[model samples]
Target: MSVPTRQASPAAPPPASVLPAVPVEPSPDPEAHLGLRFPEGFGWGAATSAYQIEGAAREDGRGPSVWDTFAYTPGRVANGDTGDTAADHYRRYAEDLDLIRDLGLRSYRFSISWPRVQPDGRGAINQRGLDFYRRLVDGLLERGISPMATLFHWDTPQALQDDAGWANRDTAYRFADYATAVFEALGESVPVWLTINEPKTVVQNGYITGHHAPGIRDEPTAYLVGHHLALAHGLGVQALRATGSASRIGGALNLHPCYAADDSPATSDAVRLYDGYENRFYLDPMFKGHYPEDVLADQGPGSPLVRGIRDGDLEIIKQPIDILAVQYYTPIYVTTDGGTVQKWPTTQAAWQQVYPPGMYDILTRVTRDYAPPSITVTENGLPCADEVGVDGSVDDAGRISFLRDHLAEAHRAIADGAPLESYHVWSLMDNFEWEVGYDQRWGLIYVDYPTQRRILKRSAAWYRRVISDNSL
Candidate 1:
């Protein structure tokens, strides 16, 4: 597949009605005199996944992933969009690295394509596929940006899925092997490694919701997949350690703090249920070395999912991690009017609500409850319908404020002893948003799909200043 080059389009004029507001004066520098500061060796970065950004799904001996099959099927994605040629990051990584450098980022977090590296998800290695990441890591190093690599980001090889997918225990072993291959190849350069990105999303959206890849709406199967993914994380860490690599390994969980709609008992119960499904299901096994008993009890007598826990699985899954990557978006509000609970004020994605305090609450809860590993706000950002005005200026004040408010809460969390190390926004550019396709714009920069032109949105410029000042 040929990658498209970004071109300059005719400049549009600024909207007269939305003039720039007067800039606020800077607050006194917080780090000036205080002994408190981000850890001397903290990381600052931006993250992207293989399937989310990389477009060369078919080139260089890369085999199909479950995502490839699901996306290509009719009615699977908005506008029938497939990741055939996403951001073209596979071919234009150098340019992308330049963008990272321009933002003065200290690190860049990206994922490896399993099918790309091990074409069939097992056996022979694809040297060509490895070379692409070699180039990407070297490029980041050349620009002084540390490369943080994730082994699995929900793009399981179609060959593996063809056999039994995550439902089969063998898939977990294959993932560990794949992890070892990646660690051996790039571990020296990529100091930070994440085992997986949001296993909950992988199981819930991909399996139960039938809204993502490997679309299967089997609740029992989805719960089982969740267990296997946790197992994979534990085994993957062991594999990376066996390589004798100096990389720091961890897992990324997407957590959204749940809030009750009212003080009623039913509403509070709804909150617990939602939290069990969203947060504790992943964290309890990881941090406490056991599944939340409440969650298991709530599953009730009718639930068909069986726990795949082996004698030593908890110890392996709870292996000490260097950091906890928390990808937070918005929180959900749960209300129980009668016998049923309802979600209110959800996003266009219909999965979340706009709640900034959730960030602070989540950070505090993780610190209070877990072993207090260094925490990084791995992914946090909003999706706005950013518009380029007639004057060629994009005014995304809403997104800008959204970032500022969240960062402010994060800063407060750090001040209150959360060991909060770094914050990486969810994305750097506007690209395909999974099942929603290109409908949602979450990028700091806007991409004109037809011409592949890149336009820095107002939020991007605002973020650049945040990076420069090292504060919000």
Candidate 2:
């Protein structure tokens, strides 16, 4: 993509000065010291979303999701790739669970497909769909792996999208109903429940950028969608509590900490707007019970983005959560011109910059700003174009280094009193990646797409050792 040239703005009244940068504690890497160790019983896990791994998109009475519609459209996904037959985990979850156990991971975090359970996004539940998850949970327990289930991972049922999707307040209510139905079925066995996963991505990629499912490029719709997602989160939490299950519930957010390219006031102002939209827009409501005022003003008072917010929505969105699941991959560095600064290195995903200090910055910032719940580093990993080696093994040294650096930062965050309990890598195995499809690989274990054979990468061996020693 080519960068657009910026034109000069007419001289006018200056906007308000930006807020001061929030202070955060920094912890040195523990790897520098030989005796360092993570807290005892610190949870170790690997995570995968349903659409990304669980294939069988049209099987077992599963209805279509927006992703299905999006991927099927030509030119939407790279190389015409889709998740129709991802890793075939739906037919091979038992073997996948065994792989997780073999990795010495104590926890396995996977998402339940909304369309799989409640095929239409509402109404009667599908027994076959629920049975799949029941078996998955039981299998995890059988292997001594705790189960963490995320309810929605941007797979909004197509039927719901036809009815205005998340822009409609009714969709939030539908989500609560769906959440309740799932909880009544599997909440007893699944110890942890993440109501929604990375809703920010849904609003930005799915709506604003038109890169993901139900692709629409409307800013007003994006805000409305984001608001409804937050409301759905609160209602989902309430539904879980109503089930009377002992499951802990929360929502996962992919937060990108923003920094100024320079110390100039203009750069700081750019960072302020970027941070407000990227981070605080979600954080403030979940933690502070209101949207960031600057972001609202940025959207303009007369914009439809501010019009959909009805009374009592924020109250519902402020529901207390037991934990805050965080998915951190990179940070944003904005210049005075409001364009991103390409000062850092990147991963296979070009947008993902290689910055370890971001882990510490995000963790401590959330700790100080939103003290409502414990923290979990739910998704963090590097994507590499991995291939099988001559010796029938995959050597992904880049991923191993990525994990070591990020895990070191995670350990430092814990030492700095971030209240982070668990850290789950982005994936257990490579499957489908949205938009870019299968081009990017972000798994400890590599899967041969043609054969569906799983091969443990060098990073997997290193991760297993870290899990075993509870240290880097």
Candidate 3:
């Protein structure tokens, strides 16, 4: 791989009034100064992915996923930690559901384990696996909590990987097959279905940086996988419509709003390409039915990503979705040389730059530009080095403060006409944190991995109050 030559595209330039001498946090709106309430009926929820929380790996006829294979390889994960028994959510889901009810959460967002449901990713429904989700959803409804289930969340079945996985276009259709199976089994019992979670993570971390499962540092192949993921998203949506279940389906994307480091012609192109790669690569195809021209040019005409795209693929990727799950974790400042500069303080996860305003910018941008019918902050929270104190309690003021600031910004976004409807913190409880493993905790409830005891942190107590009051 070599330096990508910059190319200008039709991406909208920042309004002259909005661009500042240097990118800084936007000042609070006049009403935000006094604080506002999250609208009544707005969903307050918590999110957890199957690989991160549901343990029970190799149990009940469940097959292996790519993450399992990767974690088993030495030097792949921190402290040799794996999701073998993460939080024990698979066996303790009832306890977790009770925790959500105790916290006054209106919704619970979780991902279905693909390998658990369809062991090979293509055939044979696992009755035992499907029963787990059936019970989980029933329990949520019984507790008066809405269930939003994501079909795929970074844990691709290892069987699929052996056949080229997301790098192969066929996997997109295969995903629809998997989606249909889930829909037929769960039906409208699961009201919301997210096709995929954070396709960008697969391209950037898994393939580009080799930091995630099925790790590979191949840019050409990574972008190819990105395309397939988008295709899978569309196929999943189409699959749901084909069933005529009247249930809503959408894609979960992690958007990073990019800003120019300086007011220079050279920096402008850098910002365009960076934004194209980080945001538009997924957004444009989903909402606009095309790839960003600058992004296409940067890869050159003969790249694998270009050749992989066939006639009408973009149309398939542009299916109308009922809602969009926008996961905002950070912002990026692009320089003339196509590198990034940190403009805000970071969390325990160094990549997560803590600028609450970025949440507002991204939500508003997506609303103003793509105009998705509705949006939800599916995954947003701060990772802290939290622990249980001697008093049998955990005090994580940082996580509380982080959630409050971001929720304020989110409420501001809704008032500013962003059409944002719901907000979810990243994890319901501490679990496996991917490559960094169990080192950094990002949960309102602390999970003692050894005893698997769930302790409500100060943040959980504060969030419970916020949820009950429906305000900041």
Q: After superposition, how far is residue 175 of candidate 3 from its true place, in Å?
A: 0.8
Top candidate by lDDT? 3
Candidate closer to the true structure by TM-score (higher is better), 1 or 2: 2
Q: Please list the residue runs of candidate 1 whose C-alpha ends up more than 4 Å from where it truly belongs after superposition.
A: 1-42, 300-304, 337-347
Instruction: Give per-residue CA lDDT, model 1, range 192-237, as digits (tens).
Output: 8889788888777777767778888777767778888998999998
Error of 2 at 205 (Å): 0.6
Ranking by lDDT: 3, 2, 1
Against the unseen true structure, what C-alpha lDDT does each candidate score? 0.75, 0.82, 0.84
Report RMSD for candidate 2.
Answer: 5.8
Candidate 2, clashing residue pairs?
none
Residue-level lDDT of model 2, residues 245-355, one tens digit each, is 888988898887888878899888877877887888888988778999988987787866688778888888888899999888877777786666555766657666778
Selected candidate, larger lDDT, 1 vs 2 = 2
Off by over 4 Å in 3: 1-34
Candidate 3 structure quality by residue, lDDT tens digits, 354-439? 78899999999999999999898898887777878999999887777677788888988999999888899987888898887888
The local distance difference test score of model 1 is: 0.75
RMSD (CA, Å), candidate 1 to true, equals 8.4
